[model samples]
Target: MRLTNNLLFFFILILSLYSQPVQAQSCQELETWTRLVEHEFPSVESKSVRSGSLIYNSIRFNLLSDKYFIPVFGKPFEKVGKLKKFSIKVKLTKCKKKPKFPVSKRLDWYMWGVFSQERAYNDAVKEVVLLRQLRNELPSILTKINSPMVTNDDLEDFAKIVETKFQRLLPSEINKLEKAIEKQYTIASKNQLTLAINSLKKEEASFDKLMIISKFKTDNELLLKKLDQDTRHNFFKKLAYLKTKTISELVELEEMLLPNISAVTFQDYAAINTIIDRFTTNWYPYSNLPRVEKLRNYYFELKTLLIAVNHREVIQQIINTNTLQGFKNTQEAIFKYTFSSDQIILDIKSAIVLKYRQLQLLLRIASDEVQSKSYSMATRKKLLNSVKQIQKYERVSIEGKNLINRALHKSQVLCNYIMLEELKKITEPFLSIEKKTIGDLNRLKVKIIDFKNKYKTCDGEVYDGCIKAMEGIEKNYK
Candidate 1:
């Protein structure tokens, strides 16, 4: 009976040891105890069991104690083997009690062993609920931020969330998320830039093309500053290629339009001038190009052509002038200030020579009329006036003066002959003196003989005899 009582006491003591507060032992010490159990008991297998009855629980290791030997005094000291096995429950309690830092995997397992099945299931439910909440909210936080392209503002918002709310996420994990977002952003931005560059190809106007390219350059510069260095590299290279291609297209367009400048008429002066100015300004970088140079040359040539056209108009107006002096003044002005092209100058010179030839022909025709003896005094006088009128424009050519002077001399000679004939007709009535006194008879015979003799030598002295005979008749008759 005393032995039974002592056994009962010993069992109660073991129970008391098992129920001791877990704070008395460190987690490492508890882990060491579990290891010792495994090492010492070869045949006893340990089963881990966890409890979650409360917020904090113990880890229980169910171990089967192996059959052990007992010492007994029978005749002599002897060893006896106990055939019975005992189930032992080892508890590592409070292991998961709110730790200051994260628990090690082994320590976590030790703590988890203590939870009850119901408590573990409740804990799982809580975790699953929390995971579901995070999953649902995560997409809203990440995906809703600038659907395809994430801006600096969106990135800033993400940074703020990471700093304030997602601080628990590892830097590597956060970096992966950011990279994903940035990839989308890069793709979207690249698409936009590519589309814009492609749109530029359709542009027809030089000014509009330059304006769009200029603006795009500025916007791309600003956008590049926001992108990471790695992102910037591909974007820069690709966009630069696109930019170069667009600029090349613009240059080609300008080259294509260059012929229009040469074909431009006077009516297109203002519009063409604007084109020239724009090309000079925008294409300055490519000014060394042959096509660009041609554009420049064509512009100035157009200006020169304009001057020549206006000069030709002036020349045309002058050609209609009645006097040579008007043409002379205009031609002088053209030579000094207006004339530019070789073609126009040659044309104007030819026109002037033609006018000179026409005037010379008229003078020659009038001069030929003076040689005709059938011409009346009135007709001879009219010829003299026509020759004198042409003489006014004698400066039209070098040969004009000589032609005019010869024509003037011929017309004057004809006038003299006609005047001589007129004077002879006036004297015919006086030549036969039927009722004459001796002095009158002598005067009449002298007058008739003198008039006849002078008229015959009129051509040698430029008709001086006609002038003298007229003067004597007027003096004697008066």
Candidate 2:
């Protein structure tokens, strides 16, 4: 009777534990970790986001689901030597229309992400990177990092690679945490990227459709909504296609009928020519015509501004000011990223970025000398640039050393000595590279310095030629 009672009590206890909600659990400590990085979703109520499709909305309580994306990590992720699965998520937001899922019957623009083995692994890596970055920078940013010699992105990328590799290896510490029998069932590493991006085709179609629909204003919106989903989708697609065709035809009509219809500003002329060029490469979607409206405004704005400024100065300002428009980096569907498996590439990339910063400094100084105008000064500045380049490579060796040291320090926190010792094997080849680079840099510096000291005023003829040209001009004038 006592054994039966005890067993009954145990069964009830297990059932109660299983039924407990995640929100009810003591998850405060786990929630405190802000290191988990994932795509930020837009406000759920926003018209743009409300219309997009969602894939993982139902998995909130599953133990293996992304609901637990936070500071608290499973021990299995860090202990496994071979990372069998890596997860990737792509989330897009604020879209034109929300399509019902099971993608085949869905309307345009709402893309559902299906699992790709490569995608999953890569997405997981993004978290690994974010965690590493926060580990290094959050502390430093709170205090101060004196003009960090390395770019934050470079160091963070390297740090993630190191941490991820260490995580992959079944370390002694993980073995200590889990018994051998339980290891078979534990899911250690997983990717938790939640991408909101639907389909590019659908997004483009909806945005186009909205523009065409807007011409009707409030009158037709209700009528359009009353149409069936497929009817509305086809109507929009056909309308957008016709709009694009009409614009192309109008451009041709103007060229044929009124090729010289009132001369335009130089700015307007240039912008028109650019539009012509765009027509060749662009898909000529309905959105393309709207871009020209802003550019034409620029033409008028420049013309209006020119009323106050001289043509020479205005032209100089326009020509000399190079506009390198910034673009968001197109992250790959799956980037060919180096995993924890290759430390050498990550190490080299970090060192190169640090050294590249030094080169940029030298270039800036050289640019300053160019603006000042002195032939001898220009040569001397360039010679100094060569010296800096040598010094930059010298620093590369130092950066490599620092990278190794940082890796060791971070590893020590999560791994036992035996696990770390195994990691050291991967880095052994990199040590020789560091030593070789340092030695070569030292030798090259001496040769470069000797060359700089030997550099003479070889630009004297340039000065003499300018003086002779000035005298000839005066003589001819007199």
Candidate 3:
């Protein structure tokens, strides 16, 4: 009895140790920020401590006064104060450590640093714009100084040099100057200059294929709505005509116009190419032209194609073939043609489905071997690792994760159904040899019925329920 008691005690101790939860490390930076906020904003009430499976390790706090709250990674915190009216301050330090100065003082120091840097950038932009305006007024200033007429050719040459020098500055630097000019003057040139600056910003943001696809679809829809059918058709026709025409002919036509025709229509021609690529690769072939069945279908196809080409194996293959060096040439030829986001998304979904099937295959093989007690440790490890890798690919936003989880559950249910059916098949032969073991049959019948009821609750079509049910059965049988 004492020996049994000691063994039981040991087992309980082991269980206790295993059940203890692991604590996440605190974020020193976030703690420091929190401390600073508490010190500076005494009236701001401290909220209840929020805990989850993942704890906040650290966070940077921008004290906008009365708006402070917990922040998750990658998400902007709630705005507490108006930027124009209020002076916002932030300070960073190691959590739980005593600083040389008060938190308020530290915050003030950092705020000054930030404000000074912003002032310096604004000052530089103002200087550039002032220089540009002075340069533009140079010919007039020179003529005024001489008190005689300056030749048009000399004035034009001086103006060209000034413009050339202005163009030499980076786009960002030019944008800064433009913003400074807009802030100082309320003229129409300011608005036009700001619009040009914003266009460059948009260009930088639209690099992602998904983002580009979304913008293209949005812009295309807007254009279609804005223009008449005849105008749209003519625009497309001109683009097609230009594609077939010689470069020299296009250049000659461009030269005939005061503002180059090519410059005005370049974006239109590029959009046409995108449309052509989408039709060819993503759209269903109808009379040798691409036709989309639905908007959703189009987006899905495009996303899928992009994901497929972006796969590690395909990228490695491209690198091995030394084709990546031709990126400059390929980018123009490939992306010149537009594809629908709907089509791309569809293609990505298709690839995911394929991956899901592969996982299912592995699961089935593993299950069969487990049932037979024939799978080696190495094989089991490999199967588990593959499942883990597939699970990583399944990671998305919380909503997306839920969808994937539902899909996995459905798959599991289907797997359980198959397993139960297989078990029934295997048991059929044993039934005739087991009049004495009728209790086993009764238990098996109860298990099967229980599984069916559980599956119904889980939406019988879902595989995850079936899988879970099958696992229960396996455990019970073992």
Candidate 4:
């Protein structure tokens, strides 16, 4: 009789804990804020509002604002102009429920959102600063680099090669070269007396290289004169025409000898200096600038894609892990308040776990879209193969697996999003490809629906259905 009484007491205690109700959001502050916003921004329209199980109450608003400005004149002549402003109105209904979540938890979410936005904006500013610095440094560096001294005959031949090979380079390339040369000359002229000795040295080194390569050493001065007469436009045109092999060979020679050449060894200095000079005059103006810029842009694009991919992966991981942990934490905390059965806690835990798995799958799909955008076909194929090798680790319950399928389906849609943006960049005039991409995305949506339906049919609320779906979807990627 005593043992039975003890068991009955324990059972009732558990029931009492499990039966407690969850606290709801406090409506007062939210209602006040909504009213204030509506009053201040009268033109904004609030379409929907919802408070989640968590602390945040999200309100969607469409806002329209009008700008008013006055033109001012320094002198007596200018007339002021008036502009009309239009605004759209949105309103949020006041919430009645009092939020149960702690103020600290609510504050954390708000702060995180603001911090994330600020960090992204700061990073963008840094990139722009770096780009500007690189642009500014380019011209002076080019001038410091010396060009190879070539004979009149060689110049004529090189010019002909440029005309034939680099026909695609526009006249603007020559204009840029002229501007660089003029800038260098202007700077040198400002400090002419101080620069005279260094200029002589440079000229002598250039002349010596010409002498070494020239078949007619006696006509050195004449060759130098003729070369100087050649316009920067014509010089760059010739440079653009040089074969890739010639440029590579020149760069190789300069790299090997540049370190050993000192002012004392005039011949070696001249030889290496000439190659460096050629690289600046020919390579910089024609090939190096364009190629480097193109590669940099490509790298920037790749980095951006990676950032988006990484963000999705990180957020998904956090959401999945944190949500699962949150569920566990909630159950433990609420055990004192709710006297529900162990079965109820177990069911909630299982639901939370399944939700996490679903979220993980969704994130994986989003990541895949970024990979597809940045990676080559062969690389993507290899990556997919690697994923297949790890399939066993990813397998989960039927519902979990179904969630994975849905995630993978969503990933296909994400791919379309990335591809659409990529195509816009590649296609000069935007092609009518949006429809095709949209169709592909729609198919993914249909697949997600199917996955959800199939997931619902699993026998147990938290069975092997999720795992099976995950495995099936993994196979598709492979």
Evaluated with lDDT, which candidate comes out highest?
1
Between the candidate structures 3 and 4, which one is better when assessed by lDDT?
3
The best-first sequence of candidates by TM-score reads 1, 3, 2, 4
Error of 1 at 150 (Å): 7.1
Which 10 successive residues of model 1 have the least lDDT summed? 68-77
Quote the positional error of residue 101 for candidate 1 in Å: 13
TM-scores vs. true structure, each candidate: 0.35, 0.16, 0.18, 0.13
Model 1 per-residue lDDT tens digits across residues 1-478: 9999999998886676556633324455444544443343333234333334211121112111111001111110011111111111133333445353223233445334223344543554354344335435666776765476545556666767656554323234456556755665655555566566667666664655655665665777755664668867765576566556656676677667766666766455557657766767887766786756765676666655664676556556556654556667745544432224568766767767667556545655545654655645555556566665665553444455565566666656765766567667756666555554667546655665665564453345645665566566545654
Put the candidates in lDDT order, highest first.
1, 3, 4, 2
Q: What RMSD value applies to candidate 2?
A: 40.5
lDDT of 2 at 288: 50
Model 4 lDDT tens row, 1-478: 9999999997885554334321221233433423332343333234222233111221111000000001111111112111100000000111222244232232332223222344533443343344334335445434442132222343344345334432222234333544444444423322332232234334422323333333222433332233333443343343333333343444455445433432222123224334434444543433344453443343233323332334334233334443445644533432321223444434544554555555454445445644555533333343343334334444454544554454444444443443344333433222324444555445444554554464332224232444354435434433
Please give, for residues 117-190, the per-residue lDDT of candidate 2 as tens digits: 44543544454444444444433432222222323333345445434432322233223223321221111100
Model 1 alpha-carbon miss at residue 450, Å: 66
RMSD to the true structure for each prediction, in A, is 23.4, 40.5, 40.1, 50.6
